[model samples]
Structure formats: structure tokens, C-alpha cells
Target chain A: MSDTSANRRQRVQSAETGMSVLKALARLGGDASLTAIAAEVDENAAKVHRYLLSLVQEGMVAQNAATQHYHLGPESVRIGLAALRQCDPVRMGEMALVRLRESLQVTCFIAVMGNRGPTVLRIEEPSLPVTVNMRAGSVLPWLWSASGQAFLAFSDDADIRVQAQAEFDAGNEAQRSMLAGPDPVARLCRQVKEQGCAIVIDTLLRGISAVAAPIFDARGRVVAVLTALGASNGFDARPGGKVCPQVMREAATISHAMGFGPG
Target chain B: MSDTSANRRQRVQSAETGMSVLKALARLGGDASLTAIAAEVDENAAKVHRYLLSLVQEGMVAQNAATQHYHLGPESVRIGLAALRQCDPVRMGEMALVRLRESLQVTCFIAVMGNRGPTVLRIEEPSLPVTVNMRAGSVLPWLWSASGQAFLAFSDDADIRVQAQAEFDAGNEAQRSMLAGPDPVARLCRQVKEQGCAIVIDTLLRGISAVAAPIFDARGRVVAVLTALGASNGFDARPGGKVCPQVMREAATISHAMGFGPG
Candidate 1:
């Protein structure tokens, strides 16, 4: 049987451009003049003004009457909060990392399997911060980084495998070895699932080793991966070391908070 | 000099309606058909479809290809995360509440004064689980609840007072005394400001008591209130009790996290 719905997956280009105007405003510190926003989006000021009018009307953007500048509105914040409440492993995992940061004076981060790849959602650093360039919105390769590998190892969803496979196929020869040859990705994922954690040292970032643990949801699905990044000199990420157990325990705490059972 | 900008306080009615369609979807559990969204927002299906197209373009909403159902898109989540990162006292307060919940074995909640009232943003519950009716998005009254009182007590912002005055004026004769007569709201606010906490017992719900402390922003403005709710029999809300010290300590920690210094 054929589907009859007329909904199109192909997004309208003008609408995308209009939305880009809002992103430009957000990127420009959430407030900017029409000319600035237009310049940022590389569109005409008149066209950007019309889009801003629609955005202001929709309560997604706000305009200051005196300055004639635009920023995010109250309704936008409310909508964002609603979205965060829905499936936010970011907020749920941040607290656990804070505790882990207290135990070990290292930087901790959380990554989630997003639409494109495993994206960093939050980062926690101790008082003496490490030299890390990553922040929220940084997408990591699924088979390369420890956070990405933790996601790959714990996730059993078909949709996820499709995306990871795409990332694997479009990779360099070294990257191809991760999902093929002697040490396949499937076997690694099985090991990660069995051990409840994953580790990588000096793989992605230079002199930076990261160990990540998978956070499961109520259905035991890997929703997020919590990772700790520290210098290779002092950090230990072996299977039976102090790092893995603490990370695993914190992951379990977050998983329980997310409604997973006592397992 | 007279201001030349023609921006009006009145929102664009159509844009409000368009935004309402998204709220309708969120209220309907974040996914619904066009017909359902139209019915909820009191608009026609065809007009709603046009708005949905714009939303889809903006990446604020997504339409499932097979079922033709609409839900939050990735961009909406990203925008929300960015907003949260900008001024998220909710996330900053939740971690302290988690630590408090660990020590007390009681449930804690964070509420921010929203456009309507102090709305619950996050809830931290222990494993045993207390009998609680409130959840995230539940709005608490400014005059009747502990969370509202905590907000009213510590906030010196003139805009906040206007809203609180409106809430006070809307109440019955008994509530007017809380603002006008012998035991004025100003006096109570002063007391709360001195003590740094507010308590409400058997006010809204029977056999349940709640204590709240205000969390301040960088400028020493009350941004959110951290509240602990427990059964009346086991909980204490007095100034010298165990609960008050822990709640206030946690509140102070959260305030520091939100950029408030020890003043």
C-alpha cells in the first residue's frame, strides 16, 4: 500500500533563510541591528526585516523599540525549556559529571547521538582547566573519539547504525580499520556493552585521553555518553582502573535518574 | 525627544496564533497531526499547514513523512540549549537540589517566575519517592506558595514588584492584608530577605509543607527559587531546623553557580 500524505521532506529554501536570520541574531550575542543581522546572514536588509517581522510576530524573536534591535523573546525561552524537558540527556548528565569532576580534578563532558553525529552537549571543567577547544555543538566522529565510540558501542538502534555506517564508509583508510579488518566496530561495541564503558587515549585530540560511559534511558537505550578528558600523563582509562568504575557509577546514577531500573 | 521607532507592545495576532500552534503541539505531547494542532489552536487546518511549513523551514518543527505528524525539530532544541546556556538558573539550581535530596532523602524542585507565575522547571526526587502532585511546568501562585514568596521577598527589581502587585491586587480580601494592613507583604518580604527563606504549610495542599530559598543572578537579583516539598509530619521549615540550613546552603551554592558572589 502507498502512503497518501502530501508532506514533503524537502524544506523550503526561503523559510530556511528566514530561520537563518534568527540564528544570525543568536550568534551575534542575541541582539543586533537589522543591518548587522542582514550582513551576518548575507541577505538584503529589507528581506531580513520582513523575516524579522514574522519572527517578532511569532514570539520567536523580540525587538527593542528604542534601539530597533532584535533578540530572543520570552516565548522562545519557554519553547526551548519545553524542548529541553522532552529528551534532554544534556541536563540529566551534567550533574553527574559535576560530581565526577569533584572526585578527579579533570575536565568532563557529555555527548549525545544527534542527527548528524555524536555532538557535545555540555562540558565541566575543574578549577585548573585543561586546554580543550571543544564546546557544545562540536560533532565527533562515531568510530573515532571515545565519546563517539561509547555511543556506537552501547546503541542498538537501526537508525543509529545507518548513520554510523555512513560515517564509516566515508572515511580514511585508518578510519575504515575501526569498522573492519582485525578489530571490527561490531566486536568493539559488544565489548563496550559488556563492560559498561569505553576508553581511548591520544586518538583524536593530541596528548588528551578520554574515557566515556554510556547513559541508558528507561528502555535501556543509550541516550547519552559521559566522557572525561585529561592529559595522558596522569589520567588512567584501563578496564580495571579508578576512572572506569567512577564513570560507570556516575553513568548508572544518571541512568537511574532518567528512569532506568536498579540494574 | 519623542521616540521615532514604531514598535508596538501589542503582539502581531497572526504570529501569536502561529506560535500557539507550536505550544499546542508541545501541550499535546510534542507531536500531533495538523488537524489536531488546528483544533487545539482554534485555527483552520489549511492556515495551520502554512504556518507549519514556515516552522518546518525554520527547523523549529518537523513533520514525519509517513504519518504526517509534527513535532519539535533539531534547531528548536539547539535554540533552547543556547537560551539555557545564556541564563539557566534552572540547571544551576538542580545540581544543588540533587545534592540536597541525597542528604535529606526528600524531593526538591526548582521554580522560576515565568510570565504567568513561578513555574516548576525541574524536579529532583529520591528513589523512595514522596507523594507529590506537582511536576515541571506547574505554575505556583506568587502570594500563596513558598516559592512565590521567596521570589517576592528577595527581588528588588521594579518590574518584579509590578507583577507581584498585580498578583496581590487580584487576590481576595484576606490576601490584601498580606500587602496592605497590619502584617503587610513588605514586612513579610523584609523578614524573608533577612532569613533568606520562605515556608508554606497546609496553604495550598493539605498535609504537605514546602520551604523555598531564592537563587540570585550575577547582579544579586532573584532569578529562581529552590523549593523542598515533603509531608508535614517529617519535614521542618523553621529557621534553626536541619532542613532550612541545607536548603539555604544549596540555594547559596546555586546562586554562586548562577554568578552571585558572597555579599
Candidate 2:
């Protein structure tokens, strides 16, 4: 390679290392001493400090005057919020639902926790559409529908609590009996957590089966739910079934796209 | 310098250039082609593309497969969320309030738009307390208080509209005349926006005057309002007065800390 090419390649390598340092700072939970960041990125403290000075100058990282600990700066937050605004759940979910419908040959949909409840945002039906009552704007039942169950299973929000209680109080005897126990909600939630998804068969609607999984944001909050439903006669809503895992995988993909993952 | 030292310095320079490329992308609204980013940072497209590849590898930027336009990636969102989580408005407001109280020798406070109204979250008093009826948890009226008006002026939210209208309807005849016009709310909002801060003199309380300004988040949403108040005799609540500018400066400082600014 020419000397100029070599210099350019060296510069790119250095830039990548600097980005790794920034990523390490974020991975360290957004606040850490220079020493800690250097250790995290496996670089010497002096070298890390130099990179940090550049980051600070660019307003991507800030050093606290009191503690000298580096944290993400306004530029980082601005960039993130921009990314957040761009990564629309409906758009991403629509793309994922189409892929799921094509691959699994089932009717798939995405639902977001709207002010009212789990409101369906997007739906993709296979060549043979599943004749369920739900449409794009259908608000699924809190304790009955698979999508709502998945959200309830993962959330601890006070608003969700009120909505769930109201739904339970308004349910008829048969609906209440389906979740029969001293603490049926807790039991159902525990089961869903254990299975990594929520499954329901002929519960929310007659002859309808569904499997759903929660999509989490970077903050580990459930932002949306992905669900696949079909006729109970043909759909397998079992915990360890093929559909359950597929739904979970798609949900995980969306969550990953939203910057949620294991630390 | 030794060859090794020269190489290290060159690497650092390259890293800074790469970061500039990333920042330029963010400045361009978080999505752009390599050519656009290169132009934004005033670098050659080839050099910008190389830096983008490094950023893409680090997951701080991603190129859309269909369009090949680069945007902030998941890691950028993750880091920004960390920054957002870290930049607590209450804590930052508390610090700013203390400074305002110390510098101006006036009672200063910060309020967030809570469910009820503009709810005071933090308050700092000068050596002599203002002796107001309000406390930390006091909920200021939407149309009456400077803090509330600052928020109402900046926000186009339906919730704020409902709350402001309710406050207007519940006001007594004398209180209603305080904002007298065909569309008093619109007039007040327009004045506040024009002033870039809200000011009130003996409007909410008999002997009190206050100046408040909105603290915005990364998305330019008013997340909090910073207010300073004193006895009507001592306080200067005019738009171009010393107190109004101080309050606006402090609020802008906090907003910058929260990642809000002009592009």
C-alpha cells in the first residue's frame, strides 16, 4: 500500500479504538472514572484520557468537575433521542410482522400499550388470513389476549394495574374462571415469565389461538408486543411450541433494534 | 518526537476526525449519505466513508441496506438513553436553583409538568424566605403561575390544552379578568413565547412576583420549568428585567444539560 493509504488505515484503526472507549463508557453504565474506563477498554489511562478529551471536546462525553468521572454528554443524548425518534415501533414491527407472516405462515401483528390498552398498531396476514375480530386499532383485553398478557407479564406500571383491575372487575364469570386461583394474575404472569412468552388458546376469542412476546426498549420497559394468531384447530399455542419461539425471536429482534439487550 | 510517539499522536488525530464525522452525522439530523456527511464535516467522501465504516462496525452508526444512508445505530441509542437516564432534571434543577438563590438572593424553584399541573419538585430560599403558601409539592395553576404559563406557552400538547381550559373555566370573575381577551389563553401564550420566558406580578399571589422559563429535553419538549420569585417590591418580573434573563439563562443551561439545543 502507498504511504498515504497506510496513514489513512492507521487513522481508521485509531478512530475505531476511540469509539470502543465511548462504547465502554456507556457499557460501564454511563458514569465512570478515567481509570475505570481505561480498564474497561483495556487501554492505558493516559491513552484513554487523550481519547476522552476528544470525546469531551465533541460534546459526546462530559467530565464531572466534582468527581472527575466521565459521563455521556448532550451530543450523545441528542443522538440517542434522534435514534429513538427514528426507530418507530410501528414501522419496525410492520417489517418484522411481514417477515414472520412469510416464514411462519401465520397471521402476525404488533401492539403498543396505548393510553387505553394494548392497541394493535400493525398486522400482516398470511396468504390464508386468520379470521379473527382484531384489526389495526383493536384494543386487546388485559387478562385475555396474548399480546396484553405478555405486556402485563413484564410490566409493573401503576396505570397498567388500574387498567388490569378494571378489566378483571368487568369480566363475566366465564372469563374470570379461565384465570381461576387465589392470585390468578400472578400465576399467569409467572407462567409467562418462565416460558419467555405468553400463550392463549380459545381464551380471548372463541376458536382463536395466539402467542405473543414483549418488545423492550433500552430502559428495559415493554414498549410493544408481537403476536401471531390462527384458528385454534390449526395453531399450536403451547409454551415450548415452534410458534412461541418464533414469536419470541422476532420480539427479541425488535427489542435489540431498540437498543435493549443483556448488559 | 520518537516514531512511536508520532504514531500515537497521529492515531489520536485520526480518532478525533472519526468522532467529528459521527458528530456531523448527528448534526445533519442523524441520517445522511456518506457524501452528505463528508460535506457536513468538510472532508472528502472517501475519508468520511472510511470513518463511517468504523462507526458502523462499532454499532454507533448503521447504513440502511435499501438506501445505504447512514443513521445512528443501536449503540448510539443505548448511550443516549444512558445519558437521558443520568441527566435527572430534579437534580440539575436543584443545583441551578441553589445557584440562583445564592447569586440573586431570591427564592428559586423548579417545577415539572406532573399529572395535576406544574408541580414544584425542588425549591431554594435566600437568607430571607419568601413566606409563600407554596411548598415542594405545590401544584401551580396552568394559567396563573409563571412556571405553569411557561410550560403552557411552549407546549402544543392536548393534555395541556385540557388542563389550561379547565383552569380558565374554574377561575373566579376577578381572576378571569386578569387574563381578559377574546382568546386570553392564546394571547398569554403568544406573549410568553415572544418574551421567551413567562413573568407574573401579583397575579397568582397578592405580594409575589415570579419569572419562569422552560427547560427542554433532547426532543425540544419542555420537561421542567425554573422559576424565581420574591416580594413584589423586590422582584423584577418584566420581560427584559434582570430576574427574567437570569431565570432564562439558568433554564437554558439545564436544557443544554438535558441535550436540547438548536441544530
Clashes in each model (backbone N, CA, C under 3 Å)? 0, 0
Q: Which candidate is the best by DockQ?
A: 2
Candidate 1 is scored at a TM of 0.38
Docking class of 2: acceptable
Give the DockQ-based CAPRI class for model 1.
incorrect
Q: Write the per-residue lDDT of candidate 1 for residues A34-120, one digit (tens) a residue.
A: 999999989888777767776776656766555777766544555655554564566556667788899988898888877888899
Candidate 2 lDDT over residue span B131-181, tens digit each: 998889999999889999999999989888778888899999977888878
**Tens-digit lDDT track of model 1 for B138-251:** 998876788988998887767766776677778877656545556466776887778879987766578888889988865567889999988888888778797888899998
Q: Model 2 over residues A133-226: C-alpha lDDT tens digits? A: 8898999888899999999999988777677767887989988888877877778889889999998888888999999999998778999999
Best by TM-score: 2
> Candidate 1 clashing pairs?
none
Chain B TM-score of candidate number 2? 0.86
Model 2 root mean square deviation, Cα atoms: 6.5
Please give the distance, in angstroms, between residue A13's alpha carbon in candidate 1 and its true position after superposition: 7.3
